[model samples]
Target: MAQKTVLFKHLEQPEIHRLDVYRDAGGYGALRTAVNDLAPAEVTQMVKDSGLRGRGGAGFPTGMKWSFLPKEYDTSYLVCNADESEPGAFKDRELMERNPHQLIEGCLLAAYAIRARHAFIYVRGEYLAIKELLDAAIEQARQAGLVGERIFGKDWGCEVSVYRGAGAYICGEESAMLDSLEGFRGFPRLRPPFPAVRGLYGKPTVVNNVETLANVPHIVANGAEWFKSTGTEKSPGTKICSISGPVNRPGNYELEMGTPFRYLLEDCAGGMAGGKSLKAYIPGGASAPMLPGDCQDVGIDFESYPAAGSTMGSASFILFPEDCCIVFAQLRISEFFSHESCGKCTPCREGSRWLRQMVERIEEGGGREEDLPILLDVTDNMVGKCFCALGDFATSNIVASIRHFRHEYEQHIRERRCPFRPHPAAEPLLQIAGVA
Candidate 1:
């Protein structure tokens, strides 16, 4: 967060997020260069050399994902997973809303690289303004002949359309986004056909997160070596991290990969609010396991997080100051996953309801001491038993809190009340059976 490096480079520019300013800064030149000069295969190889991975929750390599598409497929597509519904994660929304043309240019380059004829920008329904912004940008690109038929006046042409999601968290999942974009109920499909081989209308598709695609224009424009110079050897370039919760400066801060977590919190975020001591931090979005306050010194990158027993998901760093209860935080997180369960499998659908109910009972002063083991049991049953990641997504919060702060849950049960009351809005909610 210190110094606000990569992803935020344009945020401070006067109208820098606008297309005109972006072009002046050498924006869509990447697309023109790629389409005009480089072969699609060569472009993909450049991305591979740059070591760009998915900025989405999953940290899959971008070029590797694109390579998964079989060569024979005629109509491949790219769906920008702009459905930034992960709780405490809003980086993608910022990218699409502010630097939309960058994403469009990246999309065009990616479509050309993957030989995708048509692409779709699946914007989150809640971001109607961003949806409008991107739509206008796409139109502008079309008018300028940067998109649509005969892009740059060559035989190869690709067009893109913006598809609005109906505000479902499950749609953020790549396969589910395909289902939703195709006008289905947004349930996750089984993997194996994976989406590279079978996706969006039953053809090959390359789904990249908005931030991931945003980097493509930069990568294509500046060469792979230039992109490689910014961050760690394995994880190059900067990450847009959003710091909230009791921070003096609670906003998105872009920093080079592998930056220390301490620097991100204490330096970039201007330290905690009111000079309070840090308690715990959710390194990734809510779905990732929480990290104890002792682990705050770990580096913020793809490699360091798993070693620290967390993920660098979407580079979201939600800080919790001291005096905040982990039980309260865990309950809030559990409720989100439980509510967002796509109901594709019983383990998540039923297990999330039970977890929420058990946590609520403990929080509300009515739970038994024996319920602690039962909560673990519920999560244990659901962890790998569900259809999609949604089930594991629901269980991670419970397991993480219990693993790190079982004593906190016991304290709530023994005291029969929450210990800290910072905000009236923080009033704990009791679980109603069958509500989840």
Candidate 2:
């Protein structure tokens, strides 16, 4: 069943990004209520009660993250992870483009809860237009006293700024994002002092995704019970799923958490395009293990995915059609991870590159029978040994492909060619790689 839109309720409104249109639709009302009536701890408790989790890949509890700040810190910072560079993740981009104020309001409320004096949004350089939109929104909010000194005439004050990243996928990680924001190269930091303990110039910090923060205003405006009433208890509220790859209607669809995977593909996304049958799908972008087509019975939420031997990483679904070549797909995904590896850790830096080479050789019809075990071995080595999740992401698709479709790899080795034809768009690349 299609649940009513919460975060995307006002998405269709023209000029919704503008403060006037947004305010008319109850934007910033939550921040005002939070500031005027509720204490910072009270607001944090409300979010915890709402069961709101981070929409970022990790699915960490948002309120719990806020609560991690030291009670007596001199300075605390809130950083918004706006780097939507995951291969198929565009939900954050759309949310920021359509409902800028909602995110600003979320940031303000979050900062208030953490007692953060300043907040920075680390946006990817590729999202130039989104930066412009958010910058304008921030300026407008400052002028209207929705941001900056004594917001809503309350004694509390918080400033929000937009910092554009240099287009590194690793920056999406909280520690790397802080590094980039601090004018350093994007690289994951050691975890002895997590961001909650020490971040953004040695101050306690809270990092949240764009979509995750965007949900804050709604949770505050409506009561926590109302917010929790929709999705499952553990994964309450609607999720903005970005569906792509061979779907008839590939775009962002806001559905309640725990909605079945079948509902997303068939009902919301209009099923596979061009009369194609589903083969497999990445339940949550390229970093998540792909689920077989028959796993449609699985629910699209945090708890459900892990139970189904997959994950709900960013809720970016990339579907594979019947004619799609799993080996070729894995090769492409491996290449992406390889190119994006920050080289900060030997496991991710070297393992991802080696994985890409192995996948490329197999995809180009140079596979040896020993390659499969080597691939799995490489993936296992990189899984828990990397400095950050990027290394784990590099192995997700490759490992899942081997688990579900090992025969595909065997066929490539046996026949000395890709059993499936390359897509027309990939034909040039395959030819260039000497894959006849």
Candidate 3:
């Protein structure tokens, strides 16, 4: 079956980012219907029925997250996570840049459902262009009475604001984001006081991904059943996948949840670059466990990925060509986590650094046979002991690479060099290690 485009339907239109262009394409009609006709509870129920899950790393059900908010909070907030800092993830950037109004409408609908008077989009600092576009869109909506004051002349009103983060990957986590939004250093808070309970100034808050919230207007404009009709029963609605790394065509492509990975790589991404054969691919973002290239038959959905020993995290498909070294790839990933760790927990802050060192040693041909076991041991210690998922994310690529390509690490030790490709610096590193 051909991939269906939901969020990107009108994305190709050059001026679709403008307010008038968006309105002509039937924008804000859903917000009008939601505000004028449907009750707040009804909107929540509709989203629940749609079976929409978070497009963020954790595939938690979106409606379920909203339902966790207290029914009698004095004030509540809807936070849109626009931090597209995850390596190989850029779908949210495209959505916010091209269809800022769509996201605003989605935020409006979500705010209405949760009865939140104020909504904040915590966009990463790097997305300055997107922030400018969203600022213009929000101002446009405010002037037209679509946002702020009596929206569309209805009783309910919502004030949408944009907050910029200091480019911390940990801020992508909900509690950490709340801490950042509250003018504190970005660090993950302990659970039991989840964001739904106490978030954004100790008031109940609902934090959702940009793509997850972008589906709200469609669900409101059409119906729950309409939204559910597209994707699988468990993972409904279209997902915008950000394809990157060594592909002939690297860009964002929106498709139904159950579409095969083969279609995405071959038809959508135009296959691998330089006629290279497949080696390995990160099924989701860099956080997700990497899968062998032959797993292309695996369906691109939440349930399907885990069954195949991977995850559909953020749907950021990072394809690695055959020439790419897995150990070097993991070393780079480890370096990212090490640099991004908030130092909130000892295991993550220290373990991430150690993991990077281990991978670097292995890549530099200084690894001993015991280094593989040591890497696995360090990953095990870091997985559940950290404050947030960052530690676990740091482990994913290392654990998955070691599991699937243990021989790659072993060959590096036995041959005292990377067998696949010559590392010019490997000789110098081995000389420093007093090997060979």
| lDDT of every model, 2 decimals | 0.82, 0.88, 0.87
Q: 2 or 3, which is superior by lDDT?
A: 2
TM-score for each of the candidates: 0.95, 0.96, 0.96
Ranking by lDDT: 2, 3, 1
lDDT of 3 by residue, 1-436 (tens): 4489889987668688889999999999999998989999889999999999999878899888899998788899999999977887889998988889999999999999999999999999898888888999999999999989788777789999999898888889989999899898988999978889998899999999999999999999999999999988898888888887667788889989999899999999899877887888887777899999899998889999999999999988877667667787777788888998999899999999999998888888899989988999999999989878899999999999998888888988888877767643323322221111
Give the runs in model 2 whose Cα sits over 4 Å from its true position.
Answer: 425-436
lDDT of 2 by residue, 1-436 (tens): 4555988887679689889999998888999899999999999999999999999988889999888887888899999999988877889988898888989999999999998879999898999998998999999999999889998888889999999988888999889998888888988999969998999999999999988899999889998999899998889899999888777788899999999989988898899877878888888878899989889988888999999989998998877778778898888888889999999899999999999999888888899999999999998899889779899999988989999999999999989888886465334432322222
Clashing pairs in 2: none
Q: Largest TM-score belongs to which candidate?
A: 2
Model 3 TM-score is 0.96
RMSD of 1: 3.1
Q: What lDDT score is found at residue 122 in candidate 3?
A: 94
Candidate that scores best on lDDT: 2
